[model samples]
Target chain A: MTGSILEIRDLRVAFTGAAKPVRAVDGVDLALVPGEVVALLGESGSGKSVTLRSILRLHPENKTRIEGSIVAAGIDVMALSGAALADFRGKTVSMIFQEPMLALDPVYTLGAQITEAIRKHESGVSADAARKRALGLFERVRIPSPERRLDSYPHELSGGMRQRAMIALALACNPKVLLADEPTTALDATVQVQILLLLRELQRELDLAMIFVTHDIGVGVEVADRIAVMYAGRIVEIGAVRDVIRAPRHPYTIGLLSTRAQGGRLSGKRLPTITGSPPDLASLPPGCAFAPRCSSATSACLEAAPAAVELGHGHAVRCIHTAAVA
Target chain B: MIFYASKRILFTLPIMLGVTIVCFALVHLAPGDPLVSVLPPDASQVIKEQMMALYGFDRPYHEQFLRWLWRALQGDIGTSIRTGRPVSTEISKAVGNTLMLAALATAIGFLLGTLFGFVAGYFRDTWVDKAASALSVFGVSVPHYWLGMVLVIIFAATLGWLPPTGAGPGGSEDWKWNWVHVQYLILPAVTMSVIPMGIIARTVRALVAEILSQEFVVGLRAKGLSELGVFGHVVKNAAPTALAVMGIQLGYLLGGSILIETVFAWPGTGLLLNDAIFQRDLPLLQGTILVLAMFFVVLNLVVDVMQTILDPRIQRA
Candidate 1:
């Protein structure tokens, strides 16, 4: 409460099944100060989304084994249950998903769904007040014909409008920590930029701590104050956005930056993709999970995973030969 | 919405016309002269010819069909060849009993099926789910008529707790929405409901399971709704599919009620139809079948409308 609005320490989430447990999120540690937006950049299987979902304890409890702690807004999120857990979800931490159409229930009016959420968390709030709040949210999100749009179903809205509505719903309870899992990934390029700008503006205005999960470094550069690059269920690099983008130390982060279309050394040539596929979490090698795919891998790198070493200006990189690569 | 309803109604006419034509043709093509069935076996050929002439059966099939269709359009289905009574009057008397029996069975089936299905789907992979699934499978595989007979044997014959057949003691007068009449309705209605209940439970379970897996469901949970609230939303989303399934089951129940009514000698349309078929009464047979077909078409239209009302996505479509 005094330092970071959200703090996750040594969080490990493994999905146990008939075969072997897959460590989707392995010993992640993150902290978000007030008004800070951290973009978690990673490929599809890099465990970024899993790490975000773990904060709310969204994974199936029976199959997923979660260890360590998640504390948001002075409450122990991992220890909460029943009514306490429900209260922590939207009141303390809310999430927005990538596919807006799939995220909103198709049957109810957007107003009804939003108001229901409001009323569920605030028992004393009347339905009329909740509806008024929903209307205000619709206007805040810049939806056209806000009053009429409230009565419209999710399918009636365009893709961008639906995503805006989803954001509006997430902010209805005014949680301190907002977890956006690739919120703009499903939008058109122009719309994606607009949504990112809107999110950044809202985050600044409301002073909300947020985690923006995306695989695009371009998006990270555009929206994040800091960037955390994930590879095979571990944070490979973390630093200020400009610092990480300007001089990426980890091999995976370097590979990601080189593939970007803008201002990279290989911009006009064939895009520089990482040489090997990501490691399988279920049967990862004993050393660094990215070692097999790392072009700068050495005998020492193969023998053991490297610890995160701090560079100047709060930049950190997890690699044995970071100085040599730089 | 009104346009959709009108469009559906307009579409139903052609289907009803086709059904009438098919019903008329099938009865006529059936092997057996109505006169031979109506007249005494030892009667002279002269009497048979006279009877055929009286009923206008001597005319060509098309002319007879046209005549029947014309009378039918005037709200008169003509007289039964065997009973010499108006087909409309006979059907009107039988319809009330059939409707009551079918409605009760449907209500019972839908309520029980939905409850079992919700429990099964919500607690999937547990013993409660397994028991519900086993019961549904058993219900689905067991023949309705056989189930009806077994129920009658156990509840009526062996226990001697209720009447075994025939609506009640006073027949039409006995079925006046009273407890005395309800006892008579139990055996047959329960028999008719078994298959429909099983079908509905299976459909509801599958649909509920599917809905629970949808991404919006997770969003609803993330909204901080209690478990009950989440379930309420799930049922609302799944209602369209459930209603559509129930509509089909209603049609099946109506059809099945005939056999059930006959089994219990309940004096409903099924019993009347069976007697007509046995006696080779062409007019009565055609009338009963056409009415049942119309009921089916109308029921489907209502179901479609209900689904549209329940789901805005369908309305837009």
Candidate 2:
């Protein structure tokens, strides 16, 4: 009962296609305790979003092959079927997306969509009760003029407001686990900070376990308590947010930090980036997926996949030469 | 909203007027002498001249058009040259038949097409989807007359289950809403519906598939909406596109009914149009064509308004 609110064990997601299966997520494991926010930080092809989606089994069923055990709020997520699976969603685990305009149905008023989600998971809830709950969620998310905003369609709201509405909808059921896939990536910078602060405040108030997926290290630092840096479908390093930022053990994580530093304050300096592009998942290199890009790659690093070496205080890194590199 | 509607109506007026002028000119310029058709082949030159003058065919083209336009404005489309009856009366009767046929066909086509499309899109790349797609493609390619003949051969000629032609049996015009009339309508209606149904199915499948792949769909599913709920959202999101396509298909059905009515001997405007063309009955052809063109324009307007209502994005535009 005191374990992590969300536990994902050895998750592997491969998409079946015409030629060969693309391994979007490969042997990734993560867990989130109640009231904790873990940011899955990675570049575009790093499989951060795919890992988040796999938690809810949201990929197209026939095309996706998911092999893992996902337990959310003490429920066996991988074993749920039909109505049970749907019931587990939103109430037990809810998700918000990057683009609010694309996430909210254009034809429906915000109020209707939220209330319907409330009523859907709770069978006996009356329409009026659901609407009241929806109103409260809107206010909790700090959407201005919630009553009038409820009647407005998705397109009527600005980008930031729409994202807030999306958050309100995701929070309608008071889920224990919230999976946000780049939720603030599409908003303006100022709006992004406001939303991030709002999300942190809500997460604390509700004591919800959240997995925030993002590519920006800056945003990750602002919100996450712990950070899991993924590279080429695997977690390269994971630790407390400060620990990962202060002294990254994995080379890829180090490269990401360097780029962030280059983008801020040191404007005129040549931006140091990872040497090469991420390896194609369909034809990944043997040993470490990051070997070609790693500046510290060795013969041993290229021969076999490195084991995840545990550091003290729950810190871990999957690299053969962590000591030498550090 | 009222202003938008009024603007749309105003736009249609010029288009309808243009259609009437074109229809009148085409019928007049056709290589046929109304007087020769009306009078005897050996009739005296005086008799032929009198007939032409009486019908105003001897007048200048602009004068004839002006006279027709004036009469049309006063709610008189002139008398049919073939029947010698008021064109308005003939058109009214034909309108009823055509409307009944078109409504039935559109309803059947839209429902079936939408259902098939939903299945195909929801279970994309599966056997059900592939089969539905193939069936729609076949439906689209088949000619209406050919399909009507096949249906007649199967249902009427071989099976002897239904009548092959006509709105109803003789002396049953007053009872056109009876089961006998419905029995006679099925063949032609099915034939008329095939192409539209196919078109709708294809369009709906493509649109629904696209919508289902959108990020919002994933967001909805992640919220734990059941598969059925997600499908419901998909359909609602895809409706405006489907409806827009249906409106266009209905216009096509109205025009295609001409050939279908002839093949089945249905007493619709299509049949009337066929007869008018053969007889070179300029007034009847002009009246029917003008009315048909007006129906299409109005149908399109209704569709635009309905789309705007369904999707507020279009309303703002």
Candidate 3:
């Protein structure tokens, strides 16, 4: 914990609405140790993305209020204002957006954009030096013909190439923490594997602490050291990736596992899916957020929300029936 | 690229020729002959026929057109019916005056418009941008003649800073070294610049705003580029479209300066054409219209070439 590059304590974010505020991120506590890869796994609208964006204060102002202590690289996120925040964003932490095509500027060549990144963090860096570093980054990301690719615009390259360039851009500053918001989601299966492998290789090479947000549990299993399962704006389960995948504690986590497990084998028949849609943020069920979807929900589960249960060995679950289920 | 340009020019030539032919026919179609208007009501039949023959007006319309076209191709626009002066010589003097005035006005307009437009785009939602927008609207709305009269009232009539009428009392007589004539030319040029300046500023502002919102600008900002740094790059990248707009605006400015020229009596094409109409000078009037049309076509071609040059994507397209 002391070697943690980022720590979010009781982070809460809510959107302003007419009738009631929609709680996007509710009482989420997480941390990423240096060189550790923590996967924030969940379906859409599960607050995984909101938590990621809140770390960088990337959410549009005036529409949402964030309440939390986000400590990244020894700097308090909530306290850092304007220029300090921007400095922190470009130096201590860099992010790769979901859409690689939209991540890089189309007008400029890849090298120019990457050089700009290098220049942003390091003062008085010469343009020639920045370009050299950018070309080196392109090579590091395994982009073939790096020099030519450097001179090419984003549109000129393929989707996988653009994503690699984006990763190069993110790593150019050599930030301690790298936040990838579903970086491989838009790519094809082959490209996704390539990007994922490239990310793991780069992460190992750089010893970078990564926060990978993804909806695919399989992807999370592939790269994450630990997995945090999110449901209805809260972490329902957190543990080592192997332990979480082998034996899920929370009912929602179990539901996710079953849904994904059913898709493991390729068959002519359609795979079984979760029975119901995720809860709407605006009108979450009272007491337990996932109660309505849990078959094991008891009167007590409906009357009171379960507290975080420390199940030993860094595994925690927010469920009243964990012991009974096990 | 040269082949493409040549093909476009060739395609445009016949259309232009057709327009000129239509214009020539329309002038003759108007009520009352140039002969009747130019000559006295009680002229002798002998003198009337002789004047008609002298001007080649006695020939059939088709024959007269062929002769005029032949002369025009030979660079001889024929003598003015009213002034008995060569059309080319008369128009050339007026053209020199107009060139000085129009060139000055256009330069001032482009500089002011581009500068203000860049500023407005930089401080997008600020009061300065709003003020620039308001000024642009005012420039577009106000008539050139009214603007001219206003300038005359403020600078000429009240302050006695410049003369009220004519390019200068010196006229063509001492245009060679007349500093007073140059001083007198300033107001009319400034008045003529208003519409183009306003239009160019408005267009530049919109273009800059659009370019600023592009992903490239956002990427630049994320790289920790200062506002000025981001702005400079964005403007440079967006220059092709912005310059294209400026070129079209320049063409419009040339076409529109006629009213301003006439009001100030700047001895430009507008004034020469007006004089020809009053004197019923058919040759001078026809030649001036043709020249104006040619100027417009040539200017459009120049802008087209410039647009292709500035952006290679356009050239490829």
Candidate 4:
């Protein structure tokens, strides 16, 4: 059996409103092996991003209540407290944000910021050593003139440089797991490819377990070893990347693939269109959240939530009609 | 960068000149002559005419302005009619007193305010923030003169802990090292500093809170930084704005000292200007106004330069 580097089981997060809680991430389960890349693909409201934030306990205090078991590198993250949790966060896992522009403080130079990240995780290290590590990371990420660029503020650098700096900062501590939340969503097309390829190269070189979150399937195709398609707050499908992309079982997954394949032509071909949007958690229907929009949805799908079915090997589909679809 | 500072200072020169011209004309336009203010009401008209001519007040406005400007260029601010001394000497003495008072008060206010602000902002929505916010509102709303009197009533007159009026010990002419004089300064400076302190605390609280919420802060936390690490960067980054706010407050403190100085008999520039106004000593009034305007302009220029240096984004712009 292969050992998994990170495991999140039955994670549920919600915000308390006037009375009941608004479910953000409900019953999410995932596992990542070392040097593996998993793509969590979802639209804006699908709770994919929330799951990533939950792992780090980074939600606003008092606004979110998280209940789950997240074991990262043999440590139970949900049970860690204070300095221990901080220690775990810096050395065990690092995260990169979507907006590279806002991911760095405006006042500090890029070198100072990255060096700060290093010093936070490793104590008693001199500034010279930390800066040396920072320069190395910068070069690894392909930043030009690492020494000269270190003194430049985030505003002074271009978008690509800022993203690379952010990557350098994230990689400073050599975290075991790297969580990237739509990392390249904010960059231009050319810069996006550069950042994505750099992340892939770095992960391969460092043997890092990475969970890449994005709504765009195109991004998932480039670097994802496995893909988990989320709908509303549930994972509708999880399987090997090639399997899911080649022969998607869940109707929602099929709908997504077909619609995106339509390629901006409204009249050229009869393009597939999925009807309706994701359900509102506060007033959700009793059955599958995707039933309202699924073309092949049945009365059973509308009456009761479907259980996960193992199609073959590691592929799983949360729909009763998976066998028929296959 | 040097060009920016010089450009800002050059822009301020015209504003200072405008202030001088308007104030010089307005003082001249006021009812009654300076001679009437200095001499007995029943003095002979011939004597009054002679006094006005001697002072160049009898000349046309433009000619008088040119002569005053020329003398001012040579640092001859003229003599004060009331004190029978050079206006420059009177102003320098008063400026020294006022600057000492304002500087002490501002230093205390800024230090305490920034400390309180960082705490409140760090523990936002908690009891600390609530208490600090309340103090800020009170500081901003309460008049400085009223606060000064209340302080005097409590710490000086009623308690007899310190003197209600007068400045530092060993006379205003020289510096002294006395603990009592320093202690006596507490009430006046504290009273004068209330509003500025409040303003700084509020500004720092807001700036710290904003910085604390930025994406880089989240990144810092994710990098395993303790709360202290996150807060340290937040404060360092936010300090430039806090310092800028303090600078503006310093200028306003100078403007605001008029009432506090008069009530407490501190004998600063504000009090000197008040006396000149009552005595209608035109040379003293004009000289004092010019000096205050120039001081404000210079202080603002320093603030601009500090801000530009502290914030790279501003310098780049």
DockQ of 1: 0.80
Residue-level lDDT of model 1, residues A1-326, one tens digit each, is 25998988888989996499998888788888999999999999899999998888888788899998988978998898888888788778999999989989999999999999999999899999999999999999899899999999999998999999999999999989899999999999999988999999999999999999998888888898999999888888999998898898998888887776666655568866778788889987878998887777888887877788899877999898989999
Best by TM-score: 1
Q: How close to the true structure is residue A23 of candidate 4, measured as C-alpha lDDT?
A: 87
TM-score: model 3, chain A: 0.96
Model 4, position A192, has a per-residue lDDT of 94
Model 2, stretches more than 4 Å misplaced? A261-265, B42-49
**CA-only RMSD, every prediction:** 1.8, 1.9, 4.6, 2.3
Query: For residue B138, what is the lDDT in candidate 1?
Result: 88
Q: Give, for candidate 4 chain B, the lowest lDDT window spanning 10 residues.
A: B168-177
Cα lDDT of model 3 by residue, A105-165, tens digit: 6556789888877876788999999999998899999899999999877777899999999
Ranking by TM-score, best first? 1, 2, 4, 3
Q: Which wins on DockQ, candidate 1 or candidate 2?
A: 1
Q: Candidate 3 chain B — worst ten consecutive residues by lDDT sum?
A: B215-224
DockQ of 4: 0.68
Q: What is the lDDT of candidate 1?
A: 0.87
lDDT of 2 at B35: 54
Local accuracy by lDDT, each model: 0.87, 0.87, 0.82, 0.86
**What TM-score would chain A of each candidate receive against the reference chain A?**
0.97, 0.97, 0.96, 0.96
Q: Candidate 2: lDDT of B138?
A: 88
